[model samples]
Target: MRTRAKICGITRIEDIHSAVNAGADAIGFVFFPPSPRSVTQEQAKELIQHVPAYVQTVGLFVNASLDEIEQILKQAPVDILQFHGDESPEQCQQISSQVGRRWYKAIQVKPELDVINTIKSYQNVGASAVLLDTWHPELKGGTGHSFDWSKFPKLDIPLILAGGLKPDNIEDAIKTTNAYAVDVSGGVESAKGIKDQQLIEQFMQGVQRGSAK
Candidate 1:
């Protein structure tokens, strides 16, 4: 089976075009205020215009209230919601139901975490998928460090392996986990919020090679 890829933290029209041209399945926009890659509703509304059909546009949120999310959705046409905060299963379902959009929950992987149960908790809770990211004390995600892949668990639902993925090791990551998809932001970036076209091309090539094997 071929693995899917999502190019995240898009901030420009050229980057969106580049990601779509490079065959990314999804493009992410950060809505959290604290993130360096965060975009306002106006910016997201404009940027989303460049995203063509079949290529999903994901909105990344961190502990945002229902009203805040609703306010953002009122202007930005996001296809999916990604919760990258300490939101519980109930809270996730509540927000998704209110917004009428499928959602994904990001689990920060740590050695002490019960990987399986934590993933299973989201089952029947309105999460379409689960994204596993490396844990960091200060940051929610987009940390350029990788976690212990050996701790990864197989799941019935889609598992998106993110964190520290780049051209150099993406093939190995795919070969190892056989994850449903991979989410990348900094891996193919020239700097935060800016994507490098050449790196995006290389990352896609790596994904193809890895899936073939």
Candidate 2:
């Protein structure tokens, strides 16, 4: 199957068009306020307008309450919800069901952790997919740090390789992990929350080359 690409942390309408025009299957919007890439419900509503049909819109939340998510959905109803915080499998399922949307759970990959079991726990609970990302003590994601690709194992569900992915290394990442998809934010951006069109194109090109192998 072809590897899918999701361009995340989108802040501007131009970025949305850039990502879509560059063949991104999905566009992400951050709902968490602490991150510089975060966008308000209003901003997401306007930005999502530029996204054409068949290109998914994803909302990233960091331990947001049900009320908060519901309220945000009122204005900007994203196609998928990505839980990027310390949420349990039960919570992820609960919130996903309540919100009436499929969800992807982000796993912070570290050397000491039991990668297979952890991924299985979320998979058993019905996550649409598992996104493997670099682990950090304080930060949730967008760390721009990569974990050991050799640590990856064959899985039953679709795995989305994230963290530290850029035009330079994306091909190797895909070949090594054989990930069903890839998620990128800062890697394709000229600055925080601002995506570079040229970089986006390069990243997509890398994806195509990787998938071909």
**Scored by CA lDDT, what does every candidate get?**
0.93, 0.94
Per-residue lDDT tens digits of candidate 2, residues 17-107?
Answer: 9999999999999999999999999999999899999999999999999999999999999999999998999999999899899998999
Each candidate's number of clashing pairs is 0, 0
Q: What TM-score would you give candidate 1 relative to the actual structure?
A: 0.98
> What is the alpha-carbon lDDT of model 2 when measured against the actual structure?
0.94
Question: What's the lDDT for residue 138 in model 1?
Answer: 91
Candidate 1 lDDT tens digits, 1-213: 789999989999999999999899999999988888999999999999999999999999999999999999999979999999999999999999998999999999987999889998997786899999999999999999999887778889999999999999999999899899999999999999999999999999899998995
Global Cα RMSD, each model: 0.7, 0.7
Model 2 misplaced regions, further than 4 Å: none
